[model samples]
Target: MAMAVQGSRHSDFFVEGEVYCDTCRAGFVTNVTTAIQGARVRLECRHYMSASGSVERSAEGTTDATGHYRMELVEVDNRGAELVCAVALLSSPVPECHEMEVGRDRAPVTLVQDVGLATMVRRANPLGFLQTMLARYADTDTRYVDTKMRHL
Candidate 1:
């Protein structure tokens, strides 16, 4: 007869990677010529999209001390599906500065199609970036950019 072994529930979590600056072509990390210190970042994910411009359930997350964030929306019990990475920016209001600082800009989100569940290994709790920063934005008067910076 097979004996039952006690175990704890395990969840699949993925580390949200850091964002890169297009102008600098460098990692959005804060300092040390790599990851920035006191820099802010976020992760947004959505199910696959079709040609009709429709969307499905999506989740978001944030980075931690090691510049990695985690998200655990997908479950092995839930049918296997793909997800994508959306948005990378110079985050604001880091722990030292819980509020947005002057001269710092929030980068526009750049969605990547291939960031699915397959690329990562599931961990009980991911390290690096925090699961989410929950940083508040636009508390003050700030207008959304009407155009891209590529030309400027």
Candidate 2:
């Protein structure tokens, strides 16, 4: 679920990433992981206009069948100020996997053009949901007695 920032001919920037369900509540993707469709993602940018002033801009996008989402940021004026941008999870359509994973809910993106990079593409971290019931552990009585009771 890494995010990449790309530049378009129209001068607008595009941010892309993926949303998934942490089936086993693991931080990273696993063999049993599932993609989350219809999940809402947001790209937010904040810039300091002056010592006492600041502004924020945001764009929203939804995950496709493949759990991929891309958002275009338009009307963005750096104004000599560094724009701090990040992609975050907004909402998930899956009722059982709607809770946001702490520390992994947002990914920072570099949008500055003066980094001396040959390409506009930049990679980032991931955002995903954890299964509400830990279905994989439903049958296990080792650590989750309550959950195992429900399954029994």
Candidate 3:
């Protein structure tokens, strides 16, 4: 006797994320950080062996006032091959925060799955850029002095 198993199928997947400016240059998004408006973001999918050697499919959307973006990707059948997908930052309107950070530029996400589900929504981590230094900004003082040494 042999047994067979069945799994659920999904027709599409959605990727959602946010973009922000690292005010303190903390390298990550924080509550104090502000959302970047009019920022460009893109979702790219690439296959290993393509004659064109370009992105197979791509979709772009700009950030809103709240710096939130959502992209819907159609389920692609790669015929047993892996399909690479990632959400990357393209540009920022704010000149002060236009520099892209090292690891925060692009975030890889899984778009294809065989598990049983009607629809899958993946939430990507926040991507951010370092803000330019201001003329009058300064770090807090951390120096300490010994009172006894002063008396000596």
Number of the top-ranking candidate, with TM-score as the measure = 2
Candidate 1's residue-wise lDDT over 25-131, tens digit each?
22233332223334444444444554543434334555545445444444332322444434334453334223332323232222322345444443222112221
| Ranking of models by lDDT | 2, 3, 1
- Whole-model lDDT per candidate: 0.35, 0.75, 0.75
**How does model 2 fare in lDDT?**
0.75
Candidate 3 lDDT, 72-108, residue by residue in tens: 7765564314667789999999988888987998888
- Taking all chains together, each candidate's TM-score versus the true structure is 0.36, 0.75, 0.72
Residues 19-97 of candidate 2: C-alpha lDDT, one tens digit per residue: 9999877788888889999999887767744464344777888999999888876644544137677888999999888
- TM accuracy, model 2: 0.75
- Runs of candidate 3 exceeding 4 Å displacement: 1-10, 48-53, 78-81, 115-118, 135-152
Better of 1 and 2 by TM-score: 2
